[model samples]
Target: MTSFRLHKAAALVVVIIALAIGSTAPVTARDSSSTSKHVAKRIALMTSQKAAMDMLTGMAAGRSTFDRSQARAARKQLIRSTGSIRKHFRKPHLDPRSNAQPLIWHAWKDFKARAGTAEAAAKDLNTGSLSGLRRTLPGLMQSCLSCHETYRSTPNSFTTH
Candidate 1:
């Protein structure tokens, strides 16, 4: 009878210890699936931006014909993408491979302001004439450069400033 009681007490103690350890175990609060989706969205948005910019650059450099319709389409895409770009940068979705710096969330207001400026520049681009586009190109380029200088971190880059 005494042996039975001793064994029961030892089992109870072991169970209690296990419960305590289990309760204290680190839980992953982050939704990795959601994070991955956000990362993918961000990547797609950036890729689209690059594609649109490449088209613009090709026209500016005279490597491609200055098609007004194409320029307008690219400009419109840029304007639309600005909204998606903002959406994908939500604070909770951090990806290690992303070139987005933490400063984007830290200075979200400034980031949004830059995004707004970029959108406005895209809207302001004049696709009617080569000279008109040349005039507006600097503003669009500056908007891109300004954001990249502050918020983007390139692979192998030592600095974000």
Candidate 2:
């Protein structure tokens, strides 16, 4: 049982990256429309990540409360959506794509290791006990953050001013 803190840290990094992009505040004169299917793919990735983030928050809250049923439900959503979340990443880049530094594929084995950590965290989450989740989610979030650091830019990392 790895520490949930690690996972929590990872997830936070990704969340920060997502925030940096905001997926709002449209860029100027980029002609995003001019792009082919890649633009659509990026949009889908954004949506997918947002949904997953929402679900993960719920799971995190449920963790401390020992809400087994809630944990179970969250795990189910995660199991269904994890592939799509990963799928979103498996495409050509466009629209900044969260400052993904490209080292993700460059160090594919390390990337896979992070993914594996997330998978274990997910399994621990399936235990469906708030205590189990509380015990696990931190590490899970950490795993998420570690990977995102290499793949994305921290959201709101800079100010418009």
Candidate 3:
């Protein structure tokens, strides 16, 4: 297989692994100050997602040079981060530092499905060509938008779905 094919296969495997990880219960460390740890994880997850989106959108829009290796790495990281979303968001009211709404835990099933959709879209993204990237971007963004609309809050207030 070509490098593109190999990367595609690797992305699929990563998505599958992520789904498995997200479906299982998270093993959290319950220390006296676990709230701070959860807040940190939330920050890390947001940063990872932002970085991944910047890379992907940059490549798609011709703003960044397309690098298959970098794409593969970003895709893998995104899958891992999405896997952590369920685990990280489990503890509600853990921190005032996040824009994550309490609605997340209330609508857990919908949130998990959205994460799964993003993982599957990441797996399906064919960065082999600009056209392929364009084709895949919408699916990925739609998944993100759906989750953000339903579960996340803005700086001012929580968004109602």
Candidate 4:
């Protein structure tokens, strides 16, 4: 398979693994401290997402050169960060964490589906074509909205869901 195909397949696998990790295990860490636990994970996610957005934006502004090595590095880091968030959702808790509503767990299937879309779009971004990344980034952003509408954060409040 070409790199494009490999990226796409890898993304799909990541999504599948994320769902399985989040859906199968019960969250065993539900407590008043749950908020902090979630905060840490959210912070990690926000940091990683920020980096990913920055790199992709480089493509848009003609700042990032589209090299296969850079794409692979960025994608690998994203996978690690996202996978961390996904595992946080699992881990045995009676209730969901801060920045995470019970709604996400309740609608696990739909959530996973939308996340997969974002992943696939990211794969398209890594397909070794700057033009392709430019065209596809918006679609991935929309896919992200699929979840954000339901899960919004209030800065450090960690109380908004």
lDDT of each: 0.69, 0.51, 0.65, 0.53
- Location of the lowest summed lDDT over 10 successive residues in candidate 4: 152-161
Name the lDDT of candidate 3. 0.65
Structural similarity to truth (TM-score) of each candidate: 0.73, 0.56, 0.71, 0.57
Please give the distance, in angstroms, between residue 44's alpha carbon in candidate 2 and its true position after superposition: 4.8
lDDT of 4 by residue, 1-161 (tens): 23354345434433443454575543422222544444444544644565676776676668867765665677665555444445545442332333455576777777666566666665655446777667766775665555566744343321222
The CA lDDT at 113 in model 1 is 88
How many clashes show up per model? 0, 27, 0, 5
Candidate 1: tens digits of C-alpha lDDT, residues 1-161: 13354345434433443454464532322224666445645655655676788888889889999999999888888777765567668655665445688888888989888888988888898889878888887798788777887888763322322
Cα deviation at 148, candidate 2, in Å, is: 1.4
Better of 3 and 4 by TM-score: 3
Question: Candidate 4 regions off by >4 Å?
Answer: 1-35, 63-68, 91-97, 153-161
How high is the lDDT of residue 88 in model 4?
47
Q: Top TM-score: which candidate number?
A: 1
Instruction: Pick the lDDT winner.
Output: 1
| Candidate 2 residue spans exceeding 4 A from truth | 1-67, 84-86, 155-161
- lDDT tens digits, residues 1-161, model 3? 23354345434433443455564523322222566455555655655576687888899888988887787777777777666677767777554345677877888888788888888877777767778777987787777777777777763221211
Off by over 4 Å in 3: 1-32, 155-161
